[model samples]
Target: MTEQEQQTEELRCIGCGSIIQTEDPNGLGYTPKSALEKGKETGELYCQRCFRLRHYNEIAPVSLTDDDFLRLLNQIRDANALIVYVVDVFDFNGSLIPGLHRFVGDNPVLLVGNKEDLLPRSLRRPKLTDWIRQQANIAGLRPIDTVLVSAKKNHQIDHLLDVIEKYRHNRDVYVVGVTNVGKSTLINQIIKQRTGVKELITTSRFPGTTLDKIEIPLDDGHVLVDTPGIIHQEQMAHVLSPKDLKIVAPQKEIKPKTYQLNDGQTLFLGGVARFDYLHGERAGMVAYFDNNLPIHRTKLNNADNFYAKHLGDLLTPPTSDEKNEFPPLERYEFHITEKSDIVFEGLGWITVPAKTTVAAWVPKGVGALVRRAMI
Candidate 1:
């Protein structure tokens, strides 16, 4: 580990395994090096891993107890702030923090979809935008605008900022998202792209940040607020060990695949996503997901045993919680008359290989359901 990890490891909670850094949400796990110089106490305060991911995204995932991460989201309810909520293009379902709009009542929320670089190159941008808007609607949000961007590629950053400036109208704007959705990265880019200024803000690994918020000042005397990202529900991070989180989370571009399937065949898209026969024959099925994840094909007859034998090792995120506690594999069968795109949640999407019927499966909570073709 590095010096920062070494310092953070010195801290551990007496009741839980999480670490405590700054109470600043943007600067969660932000302990000044000078603070440690004062002295070391032996009671065990917060966990060390929390410190690294918070400040560095270095992957120190701590096991948080219920109270450990159940932060005061209601605090924002009373603030008259413009909400800029970011969601990962991949893992959209897992990234959703429920009751967000209700908690921040009357706040105008702008849902920004980040990491568009992972999508298939053939995806039609406008159609995808509409799909995202529909998802936001289902999430109980009437966003002032829904913008798609890739912080890594700097795609659509200018347009996003321009729109935000127009809507912001001299109001305090807060950026929030569930953990691992690239919220900090987006904010970092926004600072550099919009202002050409570099300012240090808070970030951390475990959710329910120790720090409450970070403020980025604008020229109009308005402040752009960066809030702590909440831990997502049913995410692989929550299900897997720290080692697994690194292995599963994509750090690069994704690759899409096309497979022709019959009635009795199964295609396993990595350990996190699966497809089983629900009775479609001669169906053209394509899948889009992260390239890092492996895709294994097998006969549907052996699908169950294959999953049982290779889960985590193969069909991963394999129940860090417990075997039965994990979502059972779910199967969905669909018929397509035309060429279309089939998305596999955090995984990339597969283009239909033309005029074939197919079935797909995924863990119930990992979000492998099919949406309208975004072609």
Candidate 2:
């Protein structure tokens, strides 16, 4: 093969920057032979998987194996780089990378909470930042600074860039987060603001769009690196179909729904979750979740039978194809001594008043958390 011909064969995907290949349908960067031929002529192309995800909202599972992700994380251990940890404000707990402390390796991290526009405007910024810091501290992450922004809406992007520049010390900045947390979207905005290039990296509502690291050069000789998102087993994005994800993932600012309930009443967040008011007076239990997601009410005593009979039908969001994949729900009972939120991880939370008793249930692997209310 001639040298020029060999170089042409090594072109990368314009979408996610993975080395373009025609082999292994389930592997990263798999484009079809016909697509590659067409790309060669046009000089612009996306892998088949990315094309489907972007256009059709159809996800083709590609393994970002734990070992491979850990190896990529190891690259930052000794490097003089600043870590830009992005997270979805809506799914803050699920977006957290488990064992992040082991990977950060003494480097200062700037925690940038993305999707701030999805939050209610009445929710104070200082309160949210404080809650984030407390949660990070509990998780053993000591971030030097925290900034909130909505990448899609470009809210606070300038302030975020300024914060990044202040902390980076002219070193390479590594942008990292769990899959579906809007990491790619945030990086794309930064690129556009810095270089006026829209979507320098491929992004979509689906997880795992980026398969490898993509570097963006800065005018000051430093670079910003976009790392592939790590998949957390506990995230609901793993269990739901792409179509159903849109039903649960909040598209706009959340408006809390308050339900007046007495003891022995229950509320179901579709078929995916259940909340039982085990012991409480007739008081308001406010629920925060995607506005479009359906909520059903039933007697606590009949909740079990109700779920069993109507799981995929009336209580929906399993959407037929995803119903069979649903794992048995696990229950977590809590007695609220103070104003606390019963967090359903990838889903939203329920804010119960002090002195209320509630039991929350979610898919087995997707656990729930009880935290002091942020609002």
Candidate 3:
């Protein structure tokens, strides 16, 4: 090929699928010029972001506008593909892609709930899957099947592959999810299981790690596509710094903490969320959060002043520097007619009993809602 032709030839990142470039380190698919020559010789290439993520366990922020994601969805809508929709079991509501059913056209969706290991072991699989199915239906999606797996722990990964294999039927597969839902990790697990390659795609705790679609060819000449995670602005992850994200996002199975409270009491989940027991008889409230996160209790009347006083010191997680920039918590009140969980999206949840009236507070623009108790 001519030198100009070689220079103009597009080379895509094997990890993220962005066009490889040596210019503009801040831009997508950037790698050093020396690394480009090395990649050419090695016949294996990754962009700088994925390279750092794989080797150093470091993450860099990348932007993907809604229009870009929409264009991707349009491509999926036009393709003959099986849509494998992944969602964080902990942040189900926040992980949903808005109007996804409308975007998938006639593609069959296989709903996979990731981070299942984060839930208490006592929680029944059937019940959890039922809850997920119900939630999917509510979102106007009738998934062919629902599977629960923990990509981090490599739990139920073989079963997930089997289900995908059964449903894919020689067509291409497209895995999709909102940011921080473990989609990349799940894809990495699949790559290891299928091809025996480790960490083929970048996986990190941060949001928006995968900036473009990565296609992995199957033996049948079809491919499995890993799409960039859609940004959900309402997620609490968007508000917190990386340090606080580690505190909010649980790493292991949650140990439920039960508190006996009277009508006028409050529980602070770090400085990130609040649970107020507003009315009804004294009862036990169960909290499900990261084991390391501190929960502080105080009288409901004194909750406001207490939060203001101890926010950075005792309550923590908006750390000291973050507290000043942290958005104010917005209140969401619910009268619990039955057993339910008041979820502070991206943060953890509190299980409240029937006949209790409670209020949940999360940062403004973050989602807080009630769902049937999972445990």
Candidate 4:
């Protein structure tokens, strides 16, 4: 390498695969100037963000550019690879990456619905798989297969590996998802299960942990590539702090909460989301969210003032960090002619019965949608 080449030579963090640089503190892969210099001699480095996550279980927000993820998708489009598209079963809408069909080209996609451990044990796997396939088809992205696995619990991993092997057929395997979908954890589990190497890649609840794709060689001459998660603006993970995330992101199985609401009643999901029964008869609605998250109910007429007065206190989950940056709640109205789930993007959804009318409120850009009920 020439002197000019040395100056431009890319150095990536071994822990997270982000290209190391010293200029911008807030940019991806930023390290102090002295640390960068020291790393050049030691050959082992972690970005400032990863260092804290590794040591203190703290996550500093550093977003990966959409262009970088797009470039990786473009590269994968031309390769003969098996696309293992991982999605969080709890937050399906927020986990979806739009335009994925255009980028995957002709590759066979294997939809891996992760976080199965968070669901009730009584929930049948076949029903969940059918729902996944239906949602994929509705989004115009068809998968050759759909498998449910809880990467954290290491459940159903061997069966997932068998499915991967059956479809990969001597091609590279690419794992992809929007941020916070447990893609990194799933890949790490796969690595440990297949290669006996535990956690070769860094894992965290934060988005953009893997700034670039990392490839690990397989015994069969094929490789498994872990791509940096695409940052979806609608994902709540982008707006939330680490403490708020712990409260909303369920760590254990979710026990569904059922509420009976009349036409003029409202329910609040922490301080992050709200649901109003705009024009429905007295009915039952089932909510699935983090067990620890607080749920508040009040008359619809009092909701506005209640939220304005007690947002960070009684409503909870706003914490100090998110209180200022949190955008005003935006409403998405729905006239549910059929049974459907009113989804609050990264937050869990409320399943409403047919012939009900409702409106959902979430922070701006944190999406809300209504889909045919998966249950």
Candidate 5:
């Protein structure tokens, strides 16, 4: 075996279960040389992320490539398990794993939409679940059932457990999701409810926190496996700093801001996304995003110069320091024949009227698309 592989084979992190390596600080299961030596002597080892989380309540972001995640999925395809696929209700598109249906083989899928509490209370639960089910169907997944719950708020978790029990069919359960969809938090909630342990897994706003599979024993000699979150590179979480992520990810229910715009007006969602009314009557557009995120209005004519001049100053979260490194916004034009929401994946959406032509701009790697209005 290669030297690094041999070293890794010798020691695994007690916390996350990744094989230990001291070579690359940013790599999975990385420990400092001194820490490695100490861990070897003591037989008590935690990777840097787990160590930081345990000692300082801090989270350090780590990422694995698409190939690595695909390998994990391939392993799941061979297992006789019930796949519990969790998605963020607010970021349904971003939470989708490409080819997930194919990867799950003949195993049943239970779709769980998390962050339900982030949506306005005016939206009914039945409607939300219906929407989630429809979206999943379109994505080629036929979930046995769809459940919406807010893992952070501890809402509907018990119902979710009961549902899992009904459909799991005495098989092992595998929970899978894209990074930052609150999968870790949901698993932690399950652990707490079952074993009375709190925060057993590291949960963080930063993406890709869980680097290895964590298996929890079930009473029926089965295991509930919490798999590593698959990284979606198109997400805003990949582009922003941890501080900026905190500013962008909504923490509570979003109180949408409505704007009445003429054909020539524009809206800027901080420096992260831009919306222009290229053609349409003066109409109302409602923005659903983090309540703390800044929204600025300006004439369409001045939009370009305004973004160039004030991106870091008036427009923030590519805040002053992040602006230089931030990817340039790429334009997407949409002709809206029906009432639709212009979604900037992982950022938020703006609901616009029917018979309108609009344009959206987001960071180059991020996605911007139009979908039927949710509310």
Candidate 6:
């Protein structure tokens, strides 16, 4: 046996089947890998690629396939309780679980929208709440109510509990959603707010954290249940290495920015989203997305060449051929007035430059629908 493997701490790269070492950044490895290896610690093995992608935003990811994601949802779907379906505000498409409504049965589903801080500053709360309700309807989930909260920033978490208390009313509460939707983060925030920062019983991070259902005592003798996260198909998380996911998932409040684009100018939101106003003059195109997503501007004429040369280097997460494996890109066009929120299905949104016409495109299977301007 090799000295490294013999040390009892070896990490395998699930993505490329490479033996991870601590020294390489581009290769499959991380600093933590070696430490764990020497101690023979069997930590969750993610190569440097996945590590950086998960923490930074250098790479784009491939989402999980439908069948695989459904398999993960089996337990929650069969759970005997109320379901709180949490989805990321940035990548609603990546967070959606199809046929979830059918599996809900008599238990009412609560749509918990996480990462509200990633939206543009100008977005009005009432408008956003209304839009969220419509989007949930489109997904065929009649959520008893839609609550927006940022688990990272601890926004509206208390209100979320109040809503839960009122609606759930003395029954089991199952928090469910696809991976990377901040389900774990949301749970942590709720626990911390309801309890305190120093609460000893909370599992703060990682996916499938509550590997099974975890029940916590409630005020009236009911219970708050935490369920394992199910991987949702089409999320960039599956496509990206852990390193790349952190880059795209916003870690803080997003600042909305404005852009001046002429007709046929294309803007790429990393590799995840592309916006082109097919036929318009240089008006304004404002973007409301994760602050981590780097915005690049170029003419539509050179958009293809730019992407070809810069796929992973620039236009990321949709990484090389990530979207091509899926169906064609779905096209959506919208007219602008004073202000608007352009929902890019799972990816997030770009606030439009009012009075400017624009068209946005995303992978086919992933829905790219927009509601009334939420700003």
Cα RMSD to the true fold for all candidates: 7.3, 2.2, 1.8, 2.4, 2.6, 8.1
Give all candidates' CA lDDT scores: 0.63, 0.85, 0.90, 0.87, 0.90, 0.65
Largest TM-score belongs to which candidate? 3
Off by over 4 Å in 6: 1-80, 193-210, 219-221, 312-346, 351-371
Model 4: CA > 4 A from native:
1-11, 21-45, 320-322
- TM-score comparison, 1 vs 6, better candidate: 1
Better of 4 and 5 by lDDT: 5
* Ranking, TM-score, top scorer first: 3, 2, 5, 4, 1, 6
lDDT of 2 by residue, 1-375 (tens): 655336546777767878776766776777887887897898767788777766776667767787777788889887789999998888888899888877888889999888988888999989998888888888888899999999999999999988988988879999999888999989888888988877767787777788888888876798888888888888887777777888998989999999999999999999999999999789898899999999999999999999988888888888655678888899999989999989998889999999988999998888798988877
Model 5 agreement with the true structure over 111-199: per-residue lDDT tens digits: 99999999999999999899889888888999999999999999999999999999998999999999999999999899999999887
**Least accurate stretch of 10 residues (summed lDDT) in model 5?**
57-66
> CA lDDT of 198 in candidate 1?
44
CA error at residue 214 for candidate 3, angstroms: 0.5
Instruction: Provide the lDDT at 226 for model 6.
Output: 60
lDDT of 1 at 127: 78
Q: What does the lDDT come to for candidate 6?
A: 0.65
What is candidate 1's lDDT per residue for 66-170, written digit by digit as tens? 333345456568877778889987667667778776667888888899888776667777777888888878878788888999977778889989988878867
Whole-model lDDT, model 5:
0.90
The alpha-carbon root-mean-square deviation between model 5 and the true structure, to one decimal in Å, is: 2.6
Q: Model 1 off-target regions past 4 Å?
A: 1-58, 62-71, 194-199, 202-211, 309-370
